[model samples]
Target: MSSSIISDATSKVKNMVAGEKGRKVADLDSVSQTVSPDDRITSDFGVKMGNVDEWLRVANEKKTGPMLLEDSFSRERIHRFDHERIPERVVHARGAGAFGNFRLFESIEDLTTAGVLTDTSRETPVFVRFSTVQGSRGSADTVRDVRGFAVKFYTQEGNWDIVGNNIPVFFIQDSIKFPDIIHAVKPEPHNEVPQAQSAHNNFWDFVFMHTEATHMFMWTMSDRAIPRSYRMMQGFGVNTFVLVNQKGERHFVKFHWTPELGVHSFVWDEALKLAGQDPDFHRKDLYEAIDNGAFPKWKFGIQVIPESKEHDFEFDILDATKIWPEDLVPVRYIGELELNKNVDEYFPQTEQVAFCTSHMVPGIAHSDDPLLQGRSFSYFDTQLSRLGINWQELPINKPVCPVMNFNRDGQGRHTITKGQVNYWPNRFEARPPATAQEGAYPEPPFNIQGIKARTKSDKFREHYNQAQLFFNSLSEPEKNHLAAAFSFELDHCEDPIVYERMSQRLADIDLGLAQTVAEMVGGTKPEKQTRANHGKKASKISQVEFAPAKPTIASRRIAIIIADGFDNTAYSTVKATIKAASALPFTIGPRRSEVFPAGASKKPGNGVQPDHHLEGMRSTMFDAIFVPGGAESIKTLAKSGRALHWLREAFGHLKAIGGTGEAVELFKLAFALPDLRVSATDEAIESYGVVTLSKVSPESLRESITIAKEGVGFLEKFLYQISQHKNFDRELAGLNSQVAY
Candidate 1:
């Protein structure tokens, strides 16, 4: 029986290796080629090259000298390296991308005839790129700015690109003002002092001058600007488009991508600090999630309004600066987007991929949205300068379906033609256009009568009403954060006129919000409202409405603090429990070297080594913390100022805290709250954001966290506290401010 089992295992191993070597994924990977082992260095022309590290020159054995210019290979290598870079994108220059599939949960054939949306059996491959709008390619990912969430779907019909952002609205309504807004927000050309920031004189000046930007500015000043992770924020197709059904019925639509993990953001202080500590925090977070098989996902939702009722709302449906509120037109979720694969290479995949607002399939049409109309032309035109005329020929941007066209060779063109005729009107009828019945996009039969003039509708005149609605919908903590964000931005604007004017504009939204910001920024507080607020609120505008369907610690980071003479049982049990819940557990000690347990003998290999030291990481880097008990360990931690500060900072940030045995006393000493509830005499107790257990044994520590209505255990309660994200009550009760870091 043992010999038969070994033979079967050996056969299985051989089969696995064979499968790994023959796997063929998407068409992009099928076309990919790699350098072979045992191959020598060769030039672009495939000629074998020698001494690639140094130029072929006349030199002595003892000393090197460059006296000859006959080294063609060395010159060629240097010449290619000099021209290796192409022009970076003017906007959304810094980004990361991934490959995913879109699966339609419910067919929307009634709304559109698009195959990708109507076919539930087909999985449409997609490429998504997340970016920051204003930053250059070298900018930090944690800067306060608008994030770009652009997606390109490779469908059976054609390529459909959803050029969107994290925010639903934009700063300007007319596309003619695109250059103006971009130039104003970019580093001021005169000095170029601020790198990837909106808190500058020119930016504030533009905000106060352009009345249409009031609504968008309110969103930028909110916590949405500093998202916790790209996987945790919402995505919106900022521009409105038209969707036509099989019966030629038209409806105005806005696209939305709601993350499964829910919308979350970092504190302003934490965001700023992260920029210095981890410039690529967002990029690393996304790559690591996919690498660990924790695929990120979002629900595809669309807000639709019949074409007959386009003018029924106060704001124009075609205005890019306005949003069709969910209260008026509810979002219909019909599909799921899951990113399961990371890019194989950054240059040929992530950086080279392009998205055009005009690219669409049948049943999808562009609205006369002024910004979108201009973008349709601008996106294609800019690609010519950045990627040359044959940009679409690049493997990353090519569609999976066959593309046959008469438009022939430009610079860097890869396709080879065999036919003599290259024009569309050739007698051979080569590359003929497809009929409407053959998956071709048919233009809508709509007549135009208006004169060609650069103007906007009268409905665009109103801007502050919805802005007021957004401000009023925010919860108390959200409102306070908004006020603080505005004050922070205005304080950075040294120009007195710029900040003073912005402060006065805030009164149009809410009097209290304006007063709060004005006081913090040292501006003159306005005595009256600039306009009536109209007192309105909209659901789903606040981030609090996006909590996950089920509470989970999956992908969460929990830190375990320890030192010499730590409780080995508690330490090992907590780590095992955290891993079983799919959460990551990290050990932090006074030193990275191994430290002996309380009951362990003083031997070489009988100790635990921590992942990091006390000074190596901060409380802000984790979601929660756990401290195990041992008399010597607790005594040492109580006296160490850095260890004490870690507890205070975590408590002030409203993160979950857990302790056992004498560790509960260490927490009390750090917060100096003797009156706070703890497990001094009982088995377990929880108070504020802290959970403690005085007497811990292997049996009690082995207890599982089960979610139930009654008789909940201490472990279950601790995990629930982490799922809540934050404890606002700690700040409301004047507890966080009392504790110092």
Candidate 2:
């Protein structure tokens, strides 16, 4: 080729690349059409329509006759409506998605040459879908099941997907058993009695039969399964992948996403109550957080292991049921992800968004992990079945980069290629594949030594070690919760064989845990160990260890209960303080109508209106509750059983509780605990996660709201308690159990 011709071609390619760098959002906007009141109704083919609400009937206004089938507009509307529902996902069906950007804070050029990971200047667009694994599209969000944390990165190279889960491991080691595990955990095939619940006979029976599921089932039973919110959970790739550097040096990598808000979960009772009170709790929480400008963020990290030392660990690195303990392989955080925008529409954007584990850019490749290899094929196949052959052309799933290939048309094909031929090696040498030097995906050569057989490695046989490690690693309160979870699940299993086997199975991790669950579920109490406890522990396995470096109340929901005679000064000051701290404050009264505060007129405009009535919302909806002092307000609350239940339920759930002045007397009456202390003078008393000020004044309330280990002021102490996600001390001291919530 001539110099000038070559120069022009290179310049054109550079311009195209530059234009596609940050065009993901713009590309979607081009295909998106907004509805307006000024626009008229139109047919499927863009023809103007006058009457869409009524069908074309061959009759007068007085009498109706048979509808005319010749009306193309009516037929088209009916046909579209009839075929509107597409196939929902077989798993991870209940989900919420948001658009965001991934920014690399540190480059890992030496580990991998993938531009998205090695390029620090690029702000790669990302769409993340948070989901519950076993539920249908209509199921509740707070079920005790694994959460799907899938992310799609629209990088300049192409679209890369990290289809992961909140847990770091799987229920089974091999993909062949994927269907079996999911089938057992899902609603039973015969009755379909349980919806989005694992507390059943089949699940326990399956786990007992296949000991490999022990570790993952432990995670489900722990608080991890019922996360407080999608924004507060960790995401793990759960499968081992490979990264090849420029030198062709291969390394095994595991992906991690640590949330900035810290890991937290609802108490089992609270989760159960919220599932009925608000089935869309988690979905709405994600939307509300982003809409209120409190965008959720996570730090992206990777744990890399050289191929030469893959067998350095006792457990198989590629085993889907095991975790590469962070104590051994510390995560190297290199990037950050933030969800700043919600989807414009639910059907086209969130529902139609698909993910495949096979999607990858240059310098990244799948490992020989048995489960991962199967997922690469299964995910793509599932998408094809759900969204047709040309699913990739969907607006939400399309890549921003130029895609030039000889692939022809299929169902729902959107691209219109203008050319004489769609074949490679044509007479014009058109659209040839790129060379290695031009960013082509490199395939690292490896030797195959094993025979083709259906067998697992010896390391896969050792399953109980890690399960014991996880149980031993948890905090005391977490251990108690896990035990309670096991007991509850076993109790739900009507089959005696199922619960009895599971009870003995717990002995492999801890004898005390086995005995506790066995006694609670009417199983023969295990007196001796089934398998000796390994007595080993790993760090960062407990959610408590994932607490944020600094305390914060941002995005926390606080409820302010009041009546006709509530203290205006205390209420106003606390509400303003909560908003200033970037936390949400909701007013709750007997009714949604305006309620007169102390000395305020009983007029519509003069009184304060509550965000919700006591009967409309429960204490399960808020993270904390505050009651300001007023003689009449306190008396009204004391007389109402619902209001008393609110205080007790918050206390039983170990949530932060605050009260001032006469409110302290109401708390004492509601709790009725002689051991518990309340302030009597202008002092703040914080006891068992409850903060109260018996006397309130402007001078006392003027103190700064800085959180301290031993908070001096009332607001400081209350806010400090709120910052701590939960107070396990109350549960440990047996104070929460005493409450009759």
| Best by the lDDT measure | 2
Provide TM-scores for the models.
0.93, 0.97
lDDT of 1 by residue, 527-572 (tens): 9998998888999999999988877766677899998899988888
Instruction: Kindly give the number of clashing pairs for every candidate.
Output: 0, 0
Q: By summed lDDT, which 10 consecutive residues of candidate 2 come out lowest?
A: 16-25
Give all candidate RMSDs, comma-separated: 8.5, 2.2
The candidate 1 region of ten consecutive residues with least summed lDDT is 706-715
Writing each residue's lDDT as its tens digit, candidate 2 over 1-741 gives 676765665566466546656465578657777788998888879899998888988998799999998999999988999999999999999999999999999999998999999999999999999999888999999989899999999888889999999999999889998889889989998988798889899988999999999899999899999999999999999999999999999999999999998999999999999999999999999999999999999999999999999999999999999999999999999999999999889988899999999999998999989999889889999988889999988989998887778788889999887656678776445656899998888887888798889997899999899999999999999999999999888999999999888888888889999999999998988889979887889999999999888888889999999999999899999999998888899999999999889888787798898999999999999999999999999999999999999999999999999999899999998898877889999988989889999889897675358766676889999999998979899999898899999
lDDT of each: 0.85, 0.91
| Candidate 1 overall lDDT versus native | 0.85
- Cα shift from native, residue 75, model 2 (Å): 1.9
